[model samples]
Target: MVTQDELNEKGKAAVMDFDGDVVAEIAEECISAGLDPIDLIQNGFTAGINEVGTQFEQGSLFLPHIIAASEAMSAGVEVLTPVLENLSAQAEDKGTVAIGTIEGDIHTIGKDIVATMLKVAGFNVIDLGRDVPIADFVEVVKEKKPAIVGSSALMTTTMVLQLQVEEQLKEAGVRDTVKTMVGGAPVTQDWANRIGADIYAENASDAVVKCKAAFE
Candidate 1:
């Protein structure tokens, strides 16, 4: 059985090495040793990613390193996700957030970051991935009853889909059921308000703050 200190060390090195497989193995070991998935993620994996983000921003790390760290964190998440989901505390949720990059928008870096941040902050995120159509958003909202729905668009052309999603949600009579939030390279708070989205997050971290506010 791996000790807690060893697992923590492995988790930290996994991020530094950008080794997703190593991260996953460490997480699995921790679980096999009876460690809590939520605890590992919140205290270990999240801290690693936040550090990577800072380093990347400060030019101490390059894009390749960032991608590797993201991949490693994602791998750890894959192993921990089921365990987290089965835990009673996780089931209760800080809040349910449905997220996606609008239709015609294949850009996902921003959405991925926001989703990760939300997860780190204890929000249950249902990510729709990229290029999601209007129907998916409406169907998910109806099925999951999420407290917040978020959309991202990197291009002006794809930004229109954010409005389309809002319109569909309204038409489905579930607009009021969720607080809509939108963001990306070309989005603005005014645009969010104009399109009937309840909030606009300026960045990934800001998304967490805004969603927290919406839930509060």
Candidate 2:
């Protein structure tokens, strides 16, 4: 019998090793063993990716490694998506969040991870997807009235679009209503402050922490 701790370690190793097949296998094994999928995601795979993020920050890992690990994590998440959805349906609603990658930047891996983490954390996440225009964010804020809006930009050029999101949100008369969060490789706390964003998340776990703190 595989104890939860061992399975958790296997899940983490699968992601750290960038083995999508192993991650998927772990996901299936968890389901078969009736282990909590969310537990595996949060404590196992999410923990793995969080370490990867730390390594990247410390210059021990690079973009390619991050991308591969993210993909591997995504594979495990895909297998758990159905179960997650079922569990989420029965769970109490947390605050809503609208998240996306800003215009001119089509990067989705980081954005996807954050969105998934938020959902797993019990937030009703409206994923606006990659290459989202500034106006779309404003429209969603106006229409959905989510508690938080998150924008991602992988390039220095596109990071300026996060500023535009702040400006446009104010223009739409919802700047005060919703908190704004900015992230991506090129985004820094300084840039987030310059753009008047309420939160600057360095990675997915940080995003979940700051976003949850917004409502507290």
Candidate 3:
């Protein structure tokens, strides 16, 4: 019999190794063992990605490694999506969030990680996908009436579009109804302030924390 501790270790190792298959296997074992999938995700998979983030910050890991690890983490999450959905159905809705990469930015690894983290945190996430037009964002805000709208821009040039999103939201008369969050490699707290964004997430973990706090 595989103990929960051993399964946790395997989950961590699978992510660190960037082995999506192993991570999926661990998720299956978690279900079979009647272990809480949320615990494995929090303690095992998320812990592994957190370590990878730390290493990236410490200069021991590069962008490629971060991308790979994010992909691996996403795979594990994909396998557990059905179970997560069932669990979500049984719980009270936290809030709704509409997220996307701003126009002209094709990069998605960072944004994808943040979206996954938000889903794991119990928010109903509406992923707008990469290279989303500014108008589309405003439309979603108006239609979905989500609590938060998150925009990601990875380049200095593309980051300006996040400001446009905020402006459009205001123009559409929905700015006051939804909190706006901006994040990316080139985004800064000062930038967020300059654009009148409600939140600036430094990373995936920080995004989850700040988004949750926005309600409190």
For this target, which candidate reaches the highest TM-score against the unseen true structure? 2
Native-to-model Cα distance after best TM-score fit, residue 96 in candidate 3, in Å: 2.9
Candidate 1 lDDT tens digits, 1-216 = 666766776687677778888889888888889975655655566567657767776899976776777688788877876665455345346878999998887766568767866876788889999999889999999999999889999778999889888889999999988889999877999899898889899877688788888887
Alpha-carbon runs more than 4 Å astray in model 3: 1-9, 47-67, 106-123, 153-160, 184-191, 201-216
Superior candidate under lDDT, 1 versus 2:
2
Candidate 2, residues 1-216, lDDT tens digits: the string is 787888999999999999999999999999999998867877788778777878988999998988898899889989988887777677667899999999998778778878877877789999999999899999999999999999999878899889899988888888999999999877899999898999999988799889889989
Across 66-92, the per-residue lDDT of candidate 3 in tens digits comes to 778777877887887788777766655
Whole-model lDDT for model 1 versus the true structure? Answer: 0.80
TM-score of each: 0.61, 0.77, 0.73
RMSD of 2: 3.3
> What is residue 69's positional error in candidate 1, in angstroms?
13
The Cα local distance difference test for each model comes to: 0.80, 0.88, 0.86
What is the descending TM-score order? Answer: 2, 3, 1
